[model samples]
Target: MEAVDVIEVSREAIWVALKVGGPALVIALVIGLVISLFQALTQMQEMTLSFVPKILALFLALMGLAPFMLTVLSEFTVTLMDRIVALG
Candidate 1:
């Protein structure tokens, strides 16, 4: 493949990765921030307190977003395959 084609594929790969992972990451960050604030206010320093809720929140977010994520990934895959076919 040409350099331009390679760059375009790389860019699309990065975009797809961010699109797939961004929501869960954002949810986790928000949950962590809220838990940190609560801990600060209440002075509760139990490590598990922060860990468990974040895991649960992330899990729920992932589950809720699974279908959308799959659709995005499948579309990316199809487009990538089409590009490969065109190149060949």
Candidate 2:
């Protein structure tokens, strides 16, 4: 494949990765921020406090978003396969 083809595939892979990961990451970030605010307000500085909610939130988000994530990844995979076929 040409350099342009490789670059296109790489760019697509990165975009797909970001699309798939972005929601969970965003969820986690928001949860963590809220939790931090809670902790600050309550003056309850517990390490586990930060982790438990973030984990649970991320888990729930992943569960909710799994189908969308799967579809995105699969579509990217199909695109890659089509490119491979075209190349060969």
Candidate 3:
């Protein structure tokens, strides 16, 4: 592929990555911030406390968004395959 084609593919890959990751990332960020605030107020500086909630929140977020993520990934895969087929 030419440079432009490579750039376009890379950009699409990044976009797909962002879409797949954005929800979990946002959820983790929010959970971490809230936990941080709670810890600050209560003076309970247990590092593990922050981790479990963040992980759980991220897991739940991922589960909830799985279908949409799958759809995006599948679409990307199909498009990539079609491009390969066309080139071949």
Candidate 4:
């Protein structure tokens, strides 16, 4: 493939990756921030306190978002396959 084609594919891959993973990441971030604030206010500095909630939140977010993520990934895969066929 040409350089431009390669760059475009790489950019698209990264975008797809971010889009697929963004929701869980965002959920985790929010949970972590909230837990941090609570810890700060209550002065409860248990290191493991933050992990379980974040993990659960992230799991729920991922489960909720799985269909959307699958659609995005499938679309990206189709587009990529089309591009490959066009290249060939």
lDDT by residue (1-88, candidate 4, tens digit) is: 9999999999999999999988788889899999999999999999889999998898888889999999999999999999989987
TM-score of 1: 0.97
**Per-model TM-score on C-alpha atoms:** 0.97, 0.97, 0.94, 0.94
Query: Which regions of candidate 1 fall more than 4 Å away from where they truly are?
Result: none
Q: Is 2 or 4 the stronger prediction by lDDT?
A: 2
Write candidate 3's Cα lDDT for 12-86 as tens digits. 999999999888888888999999999999999999999999998888888889999999999999999998888
* Candidate 1 positional error at 72, Å: 0.8
> How well does model 3 score by local distance difference test?
0.93
Write down the lDDT of every candidate, Cα atoms only: 0.95, 0.96, 0.93, 0.92
Clashes of each: 0, 0, 0, 0
* Ten contiguous residues minimizing lDDT sum, candidate 4: 21-30
Model 2 quality (TM-score)? 0.97
List model 2 lDDT by residue over 9-81, tens digit each. 9999999999999999999999999999999999999999999989999999999999999999999999999
Model 1, span 23-79: residue lDDT tens: 999999999999999999999999999999999999899999999999999999999
lDDT for 49 (candidate 2)? 97
User: Which candidate has the top score in TM-score?
Assistant: 2
Clashing pairs in 2: none
